[model samples]
Target chain A: MMHLPNHWPYIAAAYGLTIGCSLVLGIGAALRLRRAKTRLAAVESQLRHRESSAS
Target chain B: MRPTPYLLHRYANPGQFLRLARALQPWLSTGAIIFLTVGIVWGLFFAPADWQQGETVRIMYVHVPMAWLASSCYLGLAICGLLSLVWRHPLADLAAIEIGPVGACAAALCLITGSLWGQPMWGTWWVWDARLTSVLVLFFLYLGHIALIRAFDEPARGQRAAAILALAGAIDLPIIKFSVQWWNTLHQPDSITLTGAPTMSMTMLWPLLITTIGFTLGVAAVIFARLSAAIHESRTRQLMARSRLNRSDRSAA
Candidate 1:
């Protein structure tokens, strides 16, 4: 099509790969943090309960 | 203390870092999104095609930024290495752990995107030239950092070893930068240099700059989030271990 530029496929592929990879990595970091925080909160509360019960 | 030392000492603790990172993370991530969107849209649609490479030159928007991030991230890793060794900055090891994987991602993206650009422009999918090889080596170094950081069951041992590796791998930074100039290579010399003006036109330069800023902020946001999580996880582990010890003592009694 006249609308499309030269080497459009390569351009598209390059952008696709870059954006896709960035999104995956970014999302992965967020999820890891979320999981870590959740576990930490649970453990902290448990320990607090243990301490209070012992006292 | 001097201003520099005052600030470093003030913020050296993990608690201070977490507070700062938490406050800054949203702004950095938002800026990354805004800048990246504008840069990409401007680059892909508004910018003129190159006289030499035509439309494929657009790939430079992403490729160039990835290249920059990969190298700069390595520099950051080296700084973490130094901090870990010199002061045993508590955040340094955790920072390195978070950065290693992200740097690896950036480096891998750099290599792949470079290949894509090279294929159409240079008529090859791959080359073993200095610039290319050095980047490949950089990528491997990132992987090696990841492996070493987790290789030991004791987290301190692993973090310390990775710190040393980061410091040593820093020697490659200069080599990568000078590869084109030092030896014959398919890769072109840098168009942009600290002492010289950019060889590129303003239109192309603007988008590239914006996208680069966005990418840098994005990296920071990710690292901050990862660091905060690592700290939380660490604190919980310590408490849990103490709790377990208490439980064992009571059971023995």
Candidate 2:
């Protein structure tokens, strides 16, 4: 494993890409989940209010 | 009920699906992060430099996984589309929709990483070789699915049209896989499946395997999250329509 006159750049590229892709995926999931939770809560509340009025 | 391998019945109802998604979210996110972190570190630092390719081979760690996910996500979308078309399952339609944008993103990642890898190894930024061209077509396939899904006034019509397109695009899967064999190109054939033995050592194999699993799980986790949002949005729309109908009836009374 002695082939490193200019190997670090490749390593950096690989690492940077791995981290960047993971970040995008993780953050995107979190934001979507948050938005879903909010919408679900709002709908649930609306349904509850409608049920109470009907009763 | 026991947690099955595929969790097939857990999604039988929208409510059940929502519950399972909420329960799985944390574990999926954690698994994605941990695997990616370990895989990248191992590949970048510990994997021995290739005897022939030197450090440029490190790009394989990123490029390979993205390519795999790009192709695989389309399959996922196609399967979802089939389920939706056959069963008229709203959840299945939501899944196809949810997976489309993410699949497109994965395709873009594949393209960018492949270009980066190519620049160092192949001496060019862009090439229209069989492998590259097929992957490019896969990207366009994904874009077409996404655009078609959003083009119609009726959401169900859009979903139906998109579903048809996705099933038709399944033809490209084999074409992409066999392009290197059918054409003489700069792109290498499947390293993992090619020849009698893998050309790389154990150190390289471990990281590649780990990264592939990581990327796949990461895509699934994101898709699940997106699906949850889509379900909520659809439900809200239905409830609003029902409420409007109720109001009109009450006024008529």
DockQ for every model comes to 0.65, 0.52
Error of 2 at B86 (Å): 2.6
Best by TM-score: 1
lDDT of 1: 0.89
* Positional deviation of residue B234's Cα in model 1 after best superposition, in angstroms: 0.8
The TM-score of the first chain in every model comes to 0.80, 0.75
In model 2, the Cα lDDT at residue B192 comes to 76
lDDT of 2 by residue, B101-156 (tens): 78887788788877777776777878999888888999999999999999999989
Identify the candidate with maximal DockQ.
1
Model 1 lDDT tens row, B13-93: 888888898899899999999999999999999999888888988999999999999999999999999988898787888
| Fnat of candidate 2 | 0.53
- Steric overlap count per candidate: 0, 0
